[model samples]
Target: MSKLKLDLIKNSISYFREAVAYAQRDELDETRWKFAIINVVQAMELAFKEKLRRIHPALIYSSVDERTDTVSLKKALNRLVDPGIGGLVIAEKDPRKIETAVKLRNELTHFECEHEHEHMEAKFADIFSFMIFFYREHLGLETEEFIDYDEHQRIIGLVKARAELRTRARSYIKAENFIDVWICPSCDESTFVAQNGECCFCHHKEAVIECASCGQETLESNVIDTSNYLDWDYDEGRMVLMEDYGMEMTACQGCIETFKSKVEDMRQAQYYEYMEREAMSYSR
Candidate 1:
């Protein structure tokens, strides 16, 4: 990760720790608080030192439920903001940004080594948004007399700055389905493609898909771009993919460029969906 990206994660983690401490109870046994802090921090130590800025709040939180609720990051964050759950620390934001941040943060945090982190980073940076740490435990302030405009202004300013940075650096690419294995017809090596169904070197056809960039047709399961219709499946009550969108039997730079172009289109669709949800929230 770059120095700037790392700094953001570190700063957020530090703020998280301070918020927890600020909410500490003097009347209760300090041991409970101490252990709680240690346990959570230990899990996040690598995250802190490495400046873990993840798009998936669930992955970072990792407090899973085997038989209970499950949902998107936006939904989960909304749940945290319920008046009933005033004790959870969470970030509230424009639903679109939160959703975009989820993916970018995931790439920045978890997919760095494998998901073309270096190549895709320029675009990812623009999509990265700020998620402020708000404590569930309020500072003993009532609504009219408790909430201070100065504090709200400071936090909002920071959040806006972070979000703007993300927007500026973000790129739209739909490569989630690009991961696949295919045998090269020429080299006979197993190669992965992003968009279509083709071989890595000597592009050979496995499956065919549409090219988003140039409106060309191509193969599936090939080292291509992530642009086209995705095959989504339900597994264990979750959505999974059956096929990639772009790729062809023939491996070429032109094909790859085409795949990249399609990804941007898909990203726009994703943004729109997220914003729609936010609009609903306001109406409610």
Candidate 2:
């Protein structure tokens, strides 16, 4: 990494520590509270982009020629988790929560907002929890030194409280399907379960697809299913249609792209052959 990139990573961590301080402040003015939220969002954005830079610098930009000013928080988050768009699957948590924080930052930046301090305080706490989790898990940062000891315990308490409430609700619902039995593809543990469209552990998603060519199960987001079609068979120098063939080939996105390229080449060759035959007929 260049010095500039290294500085950015350091600066982001510094901003996160500052945000933690703001969250832990006994009394905070509205202006300072808003800044704290902004810093937290910025920290996550920078942190994710830094990780992306390590994996592939092009990932930090929306396009190959994207400028520094155009690097967006939404794009950064997508690069980290959006599978269809080639995300790295790091920071596999509820993206909506981060989006909500970003939305709050936007509103604060554009308008002079005044809200209950308690509401803002709760939001900050939640962001703090998310930040700690991301830093420790995704960024591989040791959060013990960065997080305030007392605040860390408070955040842990809040998470535990929420988990207990969710457990009680699950018991009332008595839904067996909601229970996790399969190992998560992302986390590689037994903590994989989905409710609605979201995964319980990583919040990644439940997208199962079986590749027709490879016969391997993969995420639906990573595969392409061509509309059902029939294949003709070549028999003794003659093309014959198989009326009873009814197999749909679903391929991985990579395989699909390769297959399409080959199909196009074959089509071009056939077109030239037909043109040659037509020319011969015209001469005859």
Candidate 3:
């Protein structure tokens, strides 16, 4: 790769960082939000061109009327997949994300429309992952380390939250199986639904736990609740929150109530036994 192409890649990364920063700002600033979309697409466009250039410089541009014309982003991406190019293939990358970001940029640039903060956030969330993966795969860089960790996490949270709201409104998805889906506690989206125990979007493992009584798998939160049954270490039987392995036993709601009732009955029996013994002692 020529130093010139490497420089372009560097500039594209800079633009991507700026886009993310602007996107994370207060959405009330319409200009900032708009710039975020614009910068995101531009970053992808430049980064893609750089990758193509690395494979073959002519892949990036065409000579037109003594002036160089950069190839379309879509064309550049299509060419990158060619086996002969053989530089870095974004084989597993989702094309829809880049296409959507480009479409959004064109819409924002040419026309007037309500670019809702929530919509932009969701779109950017997908783009964010796309860019990170591209940089990691092609440039061998950990792009996240270059940004503010806390701020980046906050932006990701907002984006996923917006995506969750959209997923909830999708009645078709909800009709599948009520218990089969859950709003991920980490990403807070149906997008977090994991097949192999891993969230594809955020890469967090799906936190599933088995109901101690029912023996059915459920979201960890659904199974965790306050129980009246006390731990043995406590002097008095007081209600305390318990979960698997946190105490000697943890049970689902129905079982916990049954266990509590049994404990109470046993305590009453023990009291009656003491009273009977005292009466016999007095009689003697």
Candidate 4:
């Protein structure tokens, strides 16, 4: 292995060990938990780069041709999940959890943010569990190589606690008959109540908007603004509105697909009508 690759593997293991030590501490104050999160995120980034490096040394760079800087965690993840490249299949839900962890790491590192201790603990547990699997299955590390037996058991305990916490939250939401419950993007828990526009488990709130096309509620971030798709006619010096193809200004994912199909049908009909007119003109 090249020196860079060796250093990456060494540093990643060290960071993961430090994170595990912090997580196993009996007296975990705010500082300790913060360190735990920071170290683990660093480990994940380095490990992802190491995998990319193995695939192609240039794969770790932001620009393969320029080679000016290393790739960001998000970019690295996108590359890793690309079927033609890394071929790593991440679980659908896990990607959202990983995104949440990355955001939390950034907030705790560069800015001031407050979070409940339980919520932080849950985030750490999810990352820890996923990292362990990644190290063993993806990196081909033996159990004893990256983690000691006792440390492994402690990590398992943490993961179990997180799972139990989620179960209780789900039961509470169900008992209360919260009809608008959905999986929270923040905590990866199914405790986000659409009616309340907040996650009951983690207290994370997001803007909720009703889809103009389907009339169903969705996250404001997930809605597509369809105004950009409107057709226009440039007549004289001014542009005039031509057609909207019967689409709403905003739509949900399902409605967007339907609108696209309708537009394609309209385009084909217009094409056939033009062909018929041309045929008549030629015949005449």
- Of the candidates shown, which would achieve the greatest lDDT relative to the real structure? 4
lDDT of all predictions, in order shown? 0.39, 0.64, 0.66, 0.85
CA displacement after TM-score superposition, residue 5 of candidate 2 (Å):
3.1
Predicted candidate 3 versus true structure: per-residue lDDT over 73-134, tens digit per residue: 87777777667764445534366566766787899999998765655665677677677777
Clashes of each: 39, 0, 0, 0
> Sort by lDDT, best first: what order?
4, 3, 2, 1
Question: Candidate 1 lDDT, tens digit per residue, 62-122?
Answer: 2444523434444445444445532244443234444443454454444433322222222
| Deviation of model 3 at 109, angstroms | 1.7
lDDT of 2 by residue, 48-139 (tens): 77777777777677775754553588877767676654454544445655666677788878998765453354456567777787778767
TM-score of structure candidate 3 = 0.54
Model 4: per-residue lDDT, tens digit, 196-279? 898877787899888898888887766887766667788999887687777677888758888677777887887899999999
Please, what is the TM-score per model? 0.22, 0.51, 0.54, 0.80
TM-score of predicted structure 4: 0.80
How close to the true structure is residue 152 of candidate 2, measured as C-alpha lDDT?
A: 68
Residue 238 of model 1: what lDDT?
81
Candidate 4: stretches off by over 4 Å:
22-28, 115-118, 176-178, 232-242, 267-284
Best by TM-score: 4
Q: Which candidate, 1 or 3, would have the higher TM-score against the true structure? A: 3
